[model samples]
Target: MANIEFFDRTMLEAMSLLAESRRYLTDKAEAESQKMDLEQGLANSMETMRLVARLTQVLAWLLTHRAVHAGEMSIAEATVPDRRLGGRDLCAKDSSDAAKTLPDELQSLLSRSHSLYLRIARLDDQATARAEINTKVSGGPRPQ
Candidate 1:
């Protein structure tokens, strides 16, 4: 009878510890997931910035080339035929039209990138806090 009681108490203690460990692991996994999401968001924002930079460079080059050609043609008394470059017609009535539109679009994208970065930072903090809690619960064993 005494042996049976001791065995039952030991089983109960083991079950409790198992449950605690499971809960800790679950929380740690969730934190890691959040961290991954934040990292992905940051990566996406960086890619967008790169794309915008490339677009701006292309536009500047096109505008500079057009202005230089126009100047040269005017001096030579020759007509510069309107031609399309990179799918956009350079002789469009509104040469500055696209330029005007781009600033607003770029501004909006930058704002969104800033917001995403802030969210990522917050998530990183949350992940760190969760990891610390997990470590404390596990009695100094690092949370994998």
Candidate 2:
């Protein structure tokens, strides 16, 4: 199906991005931050962690669906909302002037992660709504 193709392609891109971001955080970003003074370095470090956290949550959601596509996870098992985004409280960085001067790489990665998270959240919402509708149409118990 076309959606299966979409799923495969999305997973490939997401996983590739995960690897690239992990490498940057562990190697490049760390070293680059060390060049800053203490307070600025700590702020950079916090932003780095936030970016990584967002990416990790997105990866978890992607991997869960990958398992479903592989027939290793039931649709019901995958529908749990808590499992979707790990229930992480999103605290997006401020939009003030101080925030505008972040490194280009961090800005790019942060923007990408935000986009991916929103996309996944929308897909999850659509899937859940579809499941509820299917259940209703089939005279099965409606989703609670």
Candidate 3:
């Protein structure tokens, strides 16, 4: 059975990667992207934006789960859409041509972030359902 556990190594690793990826994407990757020719610049900037957006979504999901695990927010509060994963549709799109040309490290980071997000998303959904069940069992108000 799945539950939101904040201190586990998995959470640590995910948070670390999110932090590292953010720095790399915003600093190194963004810097190199500025030197591209006009067309290439547009493509690279667009791809970079996508990468940033995807990672940002993943970070939000992780933080919300951490808050729940820490008892700072109830499961129902965490389940609110704003606190839940956003940009699901944006993440759903297949990699674009520009994605293939990204620096190898950036490409890998993008893939890892997306895959990690999906895995965590599944865990979050299961945790939400379990929370609802527990609430009901305890005679607490049910999620609407």
What are the models' TM-scores? 0.29, 0.79, 0.74
lDDT (C-alpha) at residue 65 in model 2: 81
Which numbered prediction scores highest in lDDT against the true structure? 3
Give the alpha carbon lDDT tens digit for every residue of 1-144 in model 3: 154333365577677777887788667976777776787777667666676787677777777878877889887878765677777777645564557766777777767767776776677687678778878888977544
Q: List the residue pairs that clash in candidate 1.
A: none
What shift in Å separates residue 84 of candidate 1 from its native position after superposition?
A: 46
lDDT by residue for model 1 (34-108), tens: 444565545444433443443333333334334434464221111122211221222211222222323333334
Q: Which is the better candidate, 1 or 2, if ranked by TM-score?
A: 2
In model 2, the clashing pairs are none
Query: lDDT by residue for model 2 over 1-144, one digit each (tens)?
Result: 888899888778777778878877777886777678877777777667767777777778788888878899755567666665653465243322443556777767767766776677777777677766666777866423
Q: Rate the local accuracy (lDDT) of all candidates.
A: 0.37, 0.70, 0.71
